[model samples]
Target: MSVMTISEALHEALRGEMLRDPKVFTIGEECGFDGLYGVSTDLEKEFGDKRVIATPISEAGFVGMSVGAAMRGMRPVAELMYIDFIGVCMDQIINQAAKMCYMTGGQVSVPMVLRLPMGSGRRNAGQHSQNLESLLTHIPGLKIVAPITPCDAKGMLTAAIRDDDPVVMLEHKLCYNIRGEVPDGDYTVPFGKAAVRREGTDVTLIGWSRQVLNALEAAEILEKEGISAEVVDIRSLVPLDFDTIAASVSKTGRAVVAQECVNRGGYGGEISAQISENLFGALKAPVVRIGAKNIVPPFAHTLEDAFFPNTADIAAAVRKMMREEGSACG
Candidate 1:
């Protein structure tokens, strides 16, 4: 019940975990001194170089080291700076960390966490900004968790660290400063569970990361217009809580899945498809998706604004769904 920025909450979570567990250690580029966004600023001073190790600008090598270290009982958390850089270490993440358990017949556990800053609202251009959670989610045995609020960030991160499987924690670039109440004591939000941020009977809006914030704003606007929009923040994408999403859509009869990722082959597509398959009879209209136009995020602020889905776009989508529902009933 304490108000804190998302960054502070996450930092608190890391700090608490490191204190509670001796094996937990974090490694990344500039995460020690630079701390990039300052989430890991005081970490180096408190934990020292042995625990908060900074590495060269080599994703592949460091990621491999993390996996190797995790196999030897170290809870190594590797930060990739931006998610786009994951491509450089795909072999480590995909062939190694992900399949280690199966390859070793459950004798080995890759208890490692890969933290990456993601999303495209900061004009970080095409390479720096991108929601590639869906890509990571595609790989089996890799647990993907993306938290939108301070509470979930702390809770989910703690859970990810304790998990025996490889976890890819994607932190939204724009959600770092979002303020929310976080519990004082230790807490853990289970993975594969979706939390309904706001409930409504008219329509369901599914989003993650910064899009969840955008969806909430749109929900407020829709509420004023008599469109009760339910907002669902998907904390985990891999072990998806589609049941909760389906339940919400069942009651609402309409859905608008949104994300900062591009339209084609995005995670929204998976949700929409699953909902249509499971809740086909209950759906009043086809599930609609609001996302970045299928183009690389531009560097210019205006172009970026035009590319990413905003509150206005979400409101319009909800309005359209409402209109369609009304037409169908009449």
Candidate 2:
């Protein structure tokens, strides 16, 4: 095991995968030597221009090109500087890359990974700080994986790169500097597997990416308040681990789904609805959802703080769920 930041772990994973597989290559903006946020740092020097290719500031062009490369047998890891800019390449991502395999009747597979740096807390303003994972998650052919820790960051990246279909790996910008223990060598955390971060019986808190950290902190706060909160990290949104969530909700009886995205039309709604449908009888109260405000992320620090869901928001949601009187079964 090695203690490393999420950035370092992701860099190592990219390097290891490129070294292991000749087909694996990376193409993105400002990803040559310095890399954006240091996730792809020094990769260009090691792999040279062909493998560590850098593209111009055209998201649509580069993403489309990467899709073609993927269809032609190269496993390209295309980095979108910020997930907010996905609108620029929506055609390529939604129509081409995501639909190629299904459109071709499984004759051709788009084995590519789109790395998106997402979330708020960095005060990157409205355009750069949006958590747009829900948009991609709604698409049918794309597999979405959001890692909250260094271990999952590395493992899931490796898994996404090797996946036969198009995978969208959402990297929370706030998680870049956070340090955690990661394995020394190659490993993969299978998709649809939710990690139980904390054990409790009073309520279940479901979160992904950086929101998982907030959920963990909320769990600690709830612990002190005589409420046991079970925290579950839904690592992959596309291949969601409904079983794990259902099991946890069954044990806890109450649930709160949290995310950094806005509350309306957010991925949390999907999870909460699924819990209601599958485990309604097991629930003691309705599933609560905590997320950012519907407005664009604010540039001001205080507004930004209030915009995104935090530990306080999660704790409050859990408390509210616990305070509910009638059981869902009743």
Candidate 3:
């Protein structure tokens, strides 16, 4: 066992995987140097320049190259510096990497991992701070995982690299430095399994990545007000564990889904719909969704705080849901 931040855990996972597998290699801007968030630092020194390849500042070109490399049996971990840059490589990701295997009748697999650092709270403005996991989830043939804990950040990356499919790792910028316990050595947390951070009977708080941390904090606040809120860390979105969400929502009789993205047409809408459709009979009230304000994220620190949803927003949503449904706060 080891105490590690999410950044360190990811670095350890990549290092461990590269040591274990000959096909594994990483490529991205500055990855061969110190990486965008320090997760890939010191790797080039250990692996050499060829394996820890750095590319030109071209998202489309490098990502296309990575897809071609994956098709040729090389396991590449390609990092797109920001989630906001996805638009520049949409064709390479959505059309080529995602559709190649199915279009070829399972004859080929793009066994690559795309590490995209996302979310706000860093005052990166609208261009660099957008949360687009909701948009990515809509695409087919892509596996998306957003692990909040250092353990999952490490374990799931291992699993993503090993899986014979293209996986998109939605790593939040704010979560990189948060410390947590991580199992030492090689380990993989299976995708589609949601972790229950806290057990409660009143309502379920479902979130992924850094939003899970917000949910946990909200649960603590809700507890003080006599409301028991279960915190469900949705580890992955592509192979979503709707069953686990259903179980929690069923037990609690209510649910509140959250996302760091804007409220309009965000991923929370999909989760809320799923619960309403499958667990409709068990639901005591309509599932509430908490999301950032439907507007471009502001650059100012205070405006950014107001633009995004926080722990208070989550707790208040839960309170509103219970109150409107005539349910007890406790």
Candidate 4:
């Protein structure tokens, strides 16, 4: 086993997949040189121009190309530097890549991966930073994976690359630096499986990507406050692991869903609703959510901090729920 940052793990996975499959290719802006975040650095050199095709600043064209390639018996990884830019290529993603398999009656499959950096932090502001995984997941036939730890980042990316369908892999910008232990050899973590990052008995806190780190921090604080809070990292969103979430909520009788996206219509809302519907009678407290305020991410650091959900907000939500139950609290 070796410890690595999430970014490094992702890079390693991409490299491994490229070496394993001759048909596997990656194409996107800035990938040929150093990649946007260095995720594809040295990849072009290793794989050559034929496999690592760099394109113009045209998300639609390249995404369409990926779809075409997949139909022609090739697996492609298309990188969109920032997920906020996915709107530029919505037609190809929603109309072509996502619908091809079902629309063709299983005659064709789009074996492709859309890799993008998402979430707010580093003061990138409104245009550059947005948590739009919910938007992608809203569509049909697209598998979404929001990995939190280095291990999941490596495993899930490998899984997405090998999947028979198109997969939207959303990497949290803030999680790039977060370090964790990962196996040195090749491994594929199954999509739709949720990992219990930290287990407790009072409240279940669910998160993915960068928010998983925040959830872990909140769990530590909750422990100090004498509240046993279970933190679950929902690595996959589209094929969500509702079983793990329901089990955790059943044991704790409370749920707190957290995410970097804004509160309104965000993925957290869907997750909370699922818990409420499936485990309504088991819940001692209403399912609450911790999310960014519904507004464009602010440019200023101070304002951004206010707009984003943090450990303090998560801890407060858990405490309030525990209080309603008359559970022992600090």
Candidate 5:
């Protein structure tokens, strides 16, 4: 194993997958060069234009082309510079790539991956800084995965490329520079699996992508207050590992789900509802959700910090949940 940043691990994964499968190619804007967040840096230099094809600033056009290529049995990894731009190509992604396989009575498969750089903390403002994974998770045909660490970033990307259906891989911009130990050579992390980052009995903290790191940090802080918080990372959202989350909540008797997206319709709410529905008797308190405010991501750093849920917010949510005596009545 070698220690590397999430960016480097992603680059290594793309490089390895391209070499392993001649049909696997990447198509997106600025991907042929250094790429946004350095995940595709030096990829085109090694693989050339045929494999690492660069396109114009047309999200709908290029993504439509990627879907067509995937239908023809070619694995295309399309990069959307930001998750916010998904609106420009919703028809291609939600309608075409997602529905083709099922529409053809399972005779055809779209083995494609859409890589998106998401989340806030950078001053990218309202347009560029948004976590829209919840939108994709709502779609029936699409699969969603968010890697919090370098190891999973590499492994999950490899797995997404090899899968038969279209997968949306959400990479947090803040996690690109974070370093961790990643295994050498080709490997894949299976979907519908949850990784327990910390073990405890007091309360369960669940999150994905950068929010997982925040949950981990919150667990550490809660430890000082005599609260043993267990942290679970929901790596894949679509084929969600509800079993792991239910098990954790059952063990802890309380749960607090956190995410960087707005609270109203965030995926964290779905997690909370699932826990409540499946493990109501096991819960000592209502499942709380910690998420960003119901407002656009602000440009100012101070406002941005307040808008997004932080380590303190997670810890506080857990504390509130623990204070309850039994499951909340509807």
Candidate 6:
């Protein structure tokens, strides 16, 4: 085991994959040295330019080029810098890369990982900070993975690189420097498996990415108020682990889903609806959802705090569910 930040762990993971397979290569804007996070800084020194290629300021062109490379049997990990720019290359992702295998009768596979830095809390304002994972989930054939820790970032990136599909890896902009224990060797964390960070019988708190950390933090705060909240991290949004979610909701009889995106048309609605549809009988209260406001993220820390959901918001939601559960019982 090695203690490292999420950035270092990603660097190590990419290096390991590049060493294992010659087909694995990376491309992004200024990813080396002074790149956004320096995740591939030292990688170029080891692998040279052909493998660690950098591109011009063209999301559409580079993303399309990566999709083409993937179709030609090369594994490409293309970094899009920010998730807010997903619109710049939506057609390439949605029409070409995502549907290539199905469109070609399984003859061609788009094995690519798009590293997207997302979510607010860094004062990046509306243009730079947005949790757009909900949009990608609506589209079929695209696998989305959001890792929370250094270990998870490394393992899931490994799996995403190996998968024969177009994978969107959403990296929360605030999680880059988070330190955690990561394995020094090679490993892969399979998709669709939800990790239960806490066990409780009062309510289930479901989230992913940085929101999951808020869930865990809220769990601790709730515990102080005699509320036992269980935290479930839906690591892979596309291949959802509803079985685990269902079981947890069944055991708790209440649920609170959180998302960093706005509440309106957010992805949390899907999880909340599933609980209502499948476990309606077991539910003691309506599934509560906590998320950012519908307005754009503000640059001010105070306004951004108000716009995005946090530990306090999550705890309040769980408390409301507990009260509602009591009322339903009565």
lDDT of each: 0.89, 0.90, 0.92, 0.89, 0.91, 0.91
lDDT of 2 at 144: 93
Residue range 1-330, candidate 4, lDDT tens digits: 999988889999999999999989999987898686778879888879988888889888898899899999999999998998898899999999999999999999999999989888779999888898888879999999988888888999999999999999998777788889999999999998899988899889999887888888988988887888899998899899999998999999989999889889899999999888889999888999888898999999999999999989999998887786676433
Clashes of each: 0, 0, 0, 0, 0, 0
Tens digits of per-residue lDDT for model 6, 55-131: 88789998999999999989999997889988989999999998999989999999999999998978999899999
What is the Cα-based TM-score of model 4?
0.97
TM-score of predicted model 1? 0.97
> Which residues of candidate 3, in runs, are more than 4 Å off?
327-330
Once fitted onto the true fold, the runs of candidate 2 whose alpha carbons sit more than 4 angstroms away are 326-330
Give lDDT tens digits, candidate 5, residues 1-330.
999999999989998999999999999998988798887788888889989988999999989999999999899999989999999999999999999988999999999999999989889999999999888899999999999889999999999999999999999988899999999887999999999999999899999998898899999999999999999999999899999998888999888898999999999989988888889999877788889999989999999999999998998777776655534543
The candidate 2 region of ten consecutive residues with least summed lDDT is 321-330
Clashes by residue pair, model 4: none
Model 6 compared with the native: what TM-score? 0.98
In the range 1-330, model 1's lDDT, one tens digit per residue, is 899988898888888989999999999888778477777868888889999989999999989999999999999888888999999999999999999999999999999999999887778998998888878878998999899889998998899889999998889887799898999999999999999999998899998888888899999998998888899988889899988998899999899999888889888999999999889999889999888888888999999999989999999988887787779889
Give per-model TM-scores.
0.97, 0.97, 0.98, 0.97, 0.97, 0.98
Models, CA RMSD each: 1.3, 1.7, 1.6, 1.9, 1.9, 1.1
lDDT of 1 at 132: 83
In angstroms, what RMSD does candidate 5 have relative to the true structure? 1.9
Off by over 4 Å in 1: 325-330
lDDT: the better of candidates 4 and 5: 5
For 1-330, candidate 3 gives per-residue lDDT tens digits of: 899999999999999999999899999987877798998889999999888989888999889989999999999999988999999999999999999999999999999999999999889999999999888899899999999889999999999999999999999998899999999888899998889999999999999888888899999988999999899988889899998999999899999998999989998899999888899999988889899999998999999999999899999898888777875434
State how far residue 256 of model 6 sits from its true place (Å): 0.3
Clash total of candidate 2: 0
Model 6 lDDT vs. the true structure?
Answer: 0.91
